[model samples]
Target: MSSDPWETLRAATRARVGLGRAGDGLTTAENLRLAAAHAQARDAVHAPLDVDAVVGALGERAGPVVVSQVADRTEYLQRPDLGRRLASDHGLEAGTWDLALVVADGLSATAVHEHAAAMVDVLLPRLEGWAVAPVVVARQARVALGDEIAEALGARMVLVLIGERPGMSAPDSLGAYLTFDARPGRVDSERNCVSNIRPPDGLTYDAAAEVLVSLMTEAFRLQLTGVRLKDTGAALPSAAG
Candidate 1:
């Protein structure tokens, strides 16, 4: 057995904990590990999303690709507001849709590249009978960008699958934001989010799908999302049963 008691804990999670000290500083190995993690986080943030690969993976499920007003990665980082609006309308046809799905490269393009299309694959099967609009792939996007896209598509609700801001430990966490009555000017409080959705460590694809489906069902029934909406953990199967 190792002398370090934190070994078990360290094996259980990705978080940095119980790192031994060396002369009032982290040990060289720990310092190197932290530096590597930081580099990964930075790379996740700076990496450009491969829009062609994403659209190819999604195939017929994908609609026209779009971009936020932000010109590039540098501008996207500097101006958050620019990522919230469309560059132009893109001539999407208006239709009454129950849901509009958007896949966006947020702070971590790595997350979208790894998980967005896979998430849609799992989610679509559960949404049968609902009129879903084509999946919109967006670049240099923020959560609010989905609102304008969904509104233009005339959807009652919008689900934006975006790359969450990378953490030192988790450089590829995906997040989902759902908004009912989606339109421009919808506040964060008017949305519900499902976050940290990376598999084998974070929420699994199937599990996240279950939670999202439950929220969507309730949202449509109640005609709302956000502060008034609640996830009662009712989607998962009971242990007792």
Candidate 2:
């Protein structure tokens, strides 16, 4: 078993809030104080976001789903090639699935923590024809990593819900990038991204769920996604690109 990034992250949050430490159960006043301090400390980082913690937090649901732990970002950074896929030993899903939701700790863990599961929560129920498997990653992952995930799970489409680098205003925002027939050597524009996924900024989780369903439906009907498929209401995915 791997470490719980959310637990680790929550401890950081509590420490910032003066909650003492993990499992300490701080009082309301302590929480408020910590929140203030956390905010200040976060602001000090010019918008701090912890990608591992965030992605881990988002996958907090109880189910057949399995979440990965914080990977080594050091190797990912020093060897960009290493970040493109999970290890063969990682043992992601082995069988076929209609869709594999690959969660990554991109540049902002907080965003993954806040929005990944919530977004998937709203999306999965609406996808009638889709068989979903959860593949979570740690370290500063990237978009292309989904190709390996698709290959591992034998999935036709790969949707990666990862954290965007935190900005000054939106620190805990998540994003989804969907690619059809996702495998190796696919171009970047070959995918479609539904970004700005936090509340009050972009589409709500429920609404975005519908949009994703619609997009996938169209992709299924037309046998395409990414730049080759046409959205239900919009121009070709190329235009959206």
Candidate 3:
């Protein structure tokens, strides 16, 4: 019953558009939906990481899990610097590897809680020949934390599968960051990111895996990530079909 042409755009994206109003404000349904979304975003920020569940989801191919220097959720949001380092040598396992995969509870733990394992499932089979290290499940972590952990594990590259900052429409959106020659001092420009992984919308799991593996292959070949490397190449053999 809406006359606005923008209503057509609403079907394609989660973004709010051409919402019919009630009096001077949103309709009751819209108001309720907005409130619910706000609540979900708030809860996602404070949600705790289920470490055991995550490791179990990773199944037999898991590795030594670890926590970051960020002591708790409170500190993680307040002091991002702490989240970028390790507290002690707890899960820093010894091994030289081509890649280190870390799953971190970023701003929205809900994302990692839901998508990390599935994303891994998609990417792992494609990386059969690479010397991948144990999957590290880091709690209260930031993207840079993978750098320190990778350095400790003696890995040439690090991929951090993390929870992205939640938007009202996508509270459980997941993200990833890849760094070549990972080390403690690596800057943000040294990493490449792939974001918005979920189901029924956003980036599909299989597609995300394809993009990630492509970037990884390129990074290894060129010894760089971030701005220098782009993900426009043809898919790898495993990614095909």
Query: lDDT per model, in order?
Result: 0.94, 0.65, 0.88
Clashing pairs in 1: none
Candidate number achieving the greatest lDDT relative to the actual structure: 1
Clashing pairs in 3: none
TM-score of each: 0.97, 0.66, 0.92
Q: Over all chains combined, what TM-score does candidate 3 have? A: 0.92
Q: Which is the winner by lDDT between candidate 1 and candidate 3?
A: 1
Deviation from native of the Cα of residue 62 in model 1, angstroms:
0.9
Find the 10 residues in a row with the least total lDDT in model 2.
61-70
Q: Report the Cα lDDT for residue 104, model 2.
A: 70
The sequence of per-residue lDDT tens digits that candidate 1 reaches over residues 110-216 is 99999999999999999999999999999999999999999889999999999999999999999999999999999999999999999978888998999999999
Please list the residue runs of candidate 3 whose C-alpha ends up more than 4 Å from where it truly belongs after superposition: 1-7, 233-241
lDDT of 3 by residue, 1-241 (tens): 8777887799877899877799999999999999999999999999999989999999886777777777778888899999998888765766879999999989888998889999999889999999998798888889999999888999999999999999999999999899999988889888999889887677888888888988999898998998999878455234334
Output the better candidate (1/2) by lDDT. 1
**Ordered list by TM-score, greatest first:** 1, 3, 2
Pick the TM-score winner.
Answer: 1
Candidate 3 has its poorest 10 consecutive residues by lDDT at 232-241
